[model samples]
Target: MVGNPDEPHCVSHLHPETAMDQIIPFDPERMIWGSAPALIYLEIAVRVGVIWIWTIVLLRWVGGRSISQMSVVEFLLVIALGSAVGDPMFQADVPLLYGMLTILLVVLADKAVDHAFRYWTTAKRLVDGRPTEILREGHLSHAGLDKKGIGPTEVMEMLRRAGVRNLGQVEYAYMEPSGTVSTFLYDQPRPGLTIVPPLELRRLPAPDALSGACCTSCGLVRATADGTCAECGATEVTRAERLESREISSA
Candidate 1:
């Protein structure tokens, strides 16, 4: 009662309201603004200013990828910020409908642009930009650099950072849609590669109808069977016959 209304203890409730009947007389209209109209206009202007400033700051900090890959929390933050400041931008009322409509229109325009980019290659190139191919088959293509607006010096810098001193080591290099560079390195190749794995080397049982067992490595399991592993490419018939004879004697 003795302190100013603008003071922390009076303005903000740090603790529960006292049980004592304290009569504090103050006029809300006089304290905040002289009139309701002035208060309303001030509130609206502040809201709009806050929204505009917050949007610019967030966009500058987060970058364009924020719009491309919006998470649930980020999306909600964008919505809440816009909603909180909408009234001040468009109307003097706290519940601003015009500001909301403007926001909705902007969102719709963004969606339309996104859709157009996806459907048309030209549009995609204009909005999202096309991926640049830096390297092809151990060679660096200058055309790719031209398209990406970069020079060989910059490309070399990137390569050095990637621990690659020469272009001969690269198999493929491409720029990603998110402005990230992807590279593939060349490696040695194996010979005589087949579609199926070599299972002939491992020994297994055979039907009783065959006269002799075959080499596990060559797939000569029995004389009557295919007489080939078909997988390993090994063809040793003597080992198969010897193993089969021993099994027959044991039986």
Candidate 2:
């Protein structure tokens, strides 16, 4: 068959038994040191060093938020940069110049998107998503939690980490775009569902029967319960725990 003189023979044209040998061509020395000359290894090191320094400079320009509190755009930038910076380090076919250009283009796109997010409210909401209200007025927002794909247990864990003793201590709680929970506590907290003692424990201290009960699922306080939560339709109800004065003073 006539073929380009410069092009190698196609594997399909080779003998069936030899095709596998040609495809794999396993060599221990080639595997250890690669096919390139030893000098090429030094070139690879230089390319990697230059790219590493350039990446550091670009990251500095990108700001601390890109590294620490990455949004969707920033996350995309990281993945793109990883691919761009990694390929040219050892792949002889990929030029260092190409990798640098790719990195620059990715960073530029990220910056452009960031600028658009700042100027356009709709674009910002669509890309990064708006902060969701997880809790309001000592009660969990089931709709907000569902929208954010977070459960009550996760919200309670976040609150507990923030040193909250009970849902009553929180005036408002929001799930930020960075996936962090921000809590605003009341100066004088009302009695609500307790979050202490850990939920895993099957037993809890006896609650005062005369006091009002709170929905264990949603932390909604009611004068009395008829064995079901009105807010979330959960059957579990527990005594509303008040924030002690000492805890407020310590806080």
Writing each residue's lDDT as its tens digit, candidate 1 over 1-251 gives 38786766554546666533232334344322324454655565566546544654554344333454453224535675566455445433323343454455445545665677668768655434456787665445656755665554555556555655334455677754454567786663111111121223334445334334333331223334444544334444322222122322342
Question: lDDT for each of the candidates?
Answer: 0.46, 0.73
Q: Report, for all candidates in order, the number of backbone clashes.
A: 6, 0
Q: What's the lDDT for residue 125 in model 2?
A: 70
Clashing pairs in 1: 44-88, 200-216, 214-220, 214-221, 218-229, 219-229
What is the TM-score of each predicted model, taking all chains together? Answer: 0.35, 0.70
Which is the leading candidate under TM-score?
Answer: 2
TM-score of 2: 0.70
RMSD each, Å:
19.3, 10.4
Deviation (Å) of 101 in candidate 1: 2.6
Can you write out model 2's per-residue Cα lDDT over 1-251, one digit (the tens) per residue?
A: 68998998678865566433453333544423455565765564566456544654565444333343676566656766788889767755444555665677667667776788788989777666678898999999998887777689988988888888889999999987767789999988999988885666656444466768888888998877666776678977778889899976675
Worst 10 residues of 2 by lDDT: 23-32
Error of 1 at 200 (Å): 55
Whole-model lDDT, model 2: 0.73
Sliding window of 10 residues with minimal summed lDDT for model 1: 189-198
Shift in Å, residue 70, candidate 1: 10
